[model samples]
Target chain A: MPREDVEDLELELLLEALYRHYGYDFREYARASIKRRMWRRMMEEGLATLSGLQERVLHDPACMERLLLDLSINVTSMFRDPTFYRAVRDKIVPLLRTYPFIRIWNPGCSTGEETYSLAILLREEGLESRARIYATDINAAVLQQAKEGIFPLDRMQEFTHNYLRYGGRCSFSDYYKVYGDRARFDPSLLEHAVFAQHNLVSDASFNEFNLIVCRNVMIYFDRALQDKVHDLFYRSLVRSGVLALGHKESIRFTSHADAYEELDRQEKLYRRVL
Target chain B: MVVGGSWGGLDALGQLVALLEEGCSLALAVALHRAADSPEGAMVSYLQSRCPLPVAEAEDKDAIQPGRVYLAPADYHLLVEPGRFALSIDAPVHHSRPSIDVLFETAADAYEEASGAVILTGANDDGCRGIRHMKRRGGVTMVQDPCTAVRREMPDAAIATGAVDKVLPLDQIAAVLNGLGRA
Candidate 1:
């Protein structure tokens, strides 16, 4: 047998162990990405192989926590794609205003950058008082960061630029107060926001929402998992509810594709017509 | 698979495509750095017209077929997983979303010794680490010669890794790829 095949088997075993022991099912993640991350963890720990890394992780809970952080992609920024925000402001916000009350679910909201962006957008559009933003992620550590409402100060410039491009009304600096290397965002932005730990894979939907924004998260999952999440989102949304995905993600190949109408295809915004 | 980046990539890719024989069976995947907001399907249309082989943007979970060329969509990292191709919006690597290294590394893992990786015309050092992974996985690695490249930084970086097996000019790359397909 080849060494690569051996490593592959070891990886599968590790994922199974992670599922059985920790209730974290990464078994359906894109294999190549998982392997790359696992190998990186192995190198970081000075382990020679995936099996060695798995052994250490199984024995040490701290190691497992570190592994979880590695597996959960935390790459996000405030208004990362300004154009998507622009579309939400121009198209989605108007429809959202029609409702007397709004519930927005941001599943897989890593560190809550986009969630905060949405909150600010709602506040500017006079819908913050009537909106409830539920921000959830599989990782609790990132949830804690989201609740803190603080971000790196260096990123403020870029975030401000994105904010302006996305039709921000007030001075971007009004949203956050910088203290040295970190900026503490205004807590009022999250006044109606709820930060909680919710696993999209294993957990069931808790509430019906008017809008579901899950961007860039499903791309990490395999087809079956993607379909499962789509079903969950479909069920969680009210009729005519809006579903916004990352610019690259689409509902085209999913089972529920035909149920939704494209509100803005380029921005991946869809309305649940069925 | 063949990969290229920034400088001189358009011209080099055209030359490389022109050199290929009419019906090579090996499937090719190209990852190029593109702005996140670029018009969809533009690159695929442009490349399709220049190459004889059918060219298209790789869709998520699509089966990888032979005798076709797949271009990575902007803002997504193209990944090869067994018999199918997967797309990811996972954060950028080397500051590139459609990173050449991500594609090359995944291809190396999927095809192993049967894989062939090419690094060409780019201003950044994105594909260097990926080519090293390819060689370590017993795959063939090639880079466009720096002197012939519009920008030398990328090819030079790949060559600096010492994992490259060939450093061919743009005109010679397609013939080498054709030879590999036949082999």
Candidate 2:
């Protein structure tokens, strides 16, 4: 067989080992990004091939954890897409306020930047007192970091700029206090929030929610996996509940296209009308 | 097939995209750096207005179609798999979301020798490594002649690697694309 095919076979075996041993089913993740991350882990460990990297990861739990971090991409920032948040503030927040008690599920909430963004939005709109946010991810490490409410100080400038554009009412600096090179965000923002580990690939929905904010996460899953998760989200949402995805994602291609009506197509917010 | 451009890329890419006739019998994946908030549908509308082919902003897990142009959506990396396109929110490469390197490299891995990639006018060298990898995988590779490019650094960088199979001007590059290998 050709060398590239051999490399592909090695990656498949490694993914199998990762699943069989760790209960982490990355087999359905987008192949391009997953392969790139595996290659990065291999190079960082000074291994020349995927097979060698697989051996090390299978034997060392710590090595697997490192690979896990690489696999679960954390390329996020607070209110990264300011316009999306602006739309949420202008359109979705009013709907959220109607509920006597709001329940939001933020799956794949890596490191919780957007979750905190949502929390702050709630507090500003006077809905924080009755809102319950369940911020969950497949990786416990990110959840731990999310609970800490700290972020890199360098990213603050960009976050601040985004906050201003998203119509933040107060000074962006009011939320966090600096500690050395990092900024520890106000823990009170998460006062009604709960952080936990929940794998979207394997776990069942534990509770119905009034809103679901799963942005940029499904882009990493294959179509079949994306459909499965969308079904989960559909079932997890209450009647006329809101679902917000990343700007680029759409439900039109999936089986659930008719199951919901468009709330704001440009902003990728949908309302379940069926 | 895959094509990449940046900085003065709108005209360069639009010209190339316009060359993909309705019966071109080839799929084209394109990447160009664009702002996260580039006024929804404006870019696709502009590109579509210039070309006879159907122009689209790529979505995750989209099936690759022949005689169509797929533009990398803003703030996402467009990657190709066997017969489908995948999107990623992975960190930008070369400070560029929708990095040409990410698109071309994945295209090379997915299609191997069946792939054909063109590196056009760009300010940065994002497509160099990807085009190099394509050439090594026996895929056809080409670069727009630096002198003919609005931004020469990108094509010059690819030429410096000695992996480009051909270096041509804009008109000739479009001609070569018109005469695609039908991969």
Judge candidate 2 at residue A84 and give its lDDT: 87
lDDT of the structure predicted as candidate 1: 0.87
Q: Highest lDDT among the candidates is held by which one?
A: 2
Please give the range of 10 consecutive residues that has the lowest summed lDDT in model 1 chain A: A68-77
- For model 2, the DockQ equals 0.70
Q: Indicate the worst ten consecutive residues by lDDT in candidate 2 chain A.
A: A68-77
Give lDDT tens digits, candidate 1, residues A1-274: 9877898899999999999989999999878878878887899999998899889998999998888878765567788778889899899989998999999999988787888899989988999999999999898888888889889899898888878878789988999998989999999999999998899999999999999999888878888999999999999999999999976678988999999999997889999999
- RMSD to native for every prediction? 2.3, 1.6
Quick one: how many clashes does candidate 1 have? 0
How close to the true structure is residue B164 of candidate 1, measured as C-alpha lDDT?
92
Model 2 per-residue lDDT tens digits across residues A1-274: 9999999899999999999999899898888889988998999999999999989998999999889888765687898788889898898888888899999999999889989999998998899999999999998888898999888899999899889988899899999999999999999999999998999999999998999999999988888899999999999999999999987788988888898999887789999998
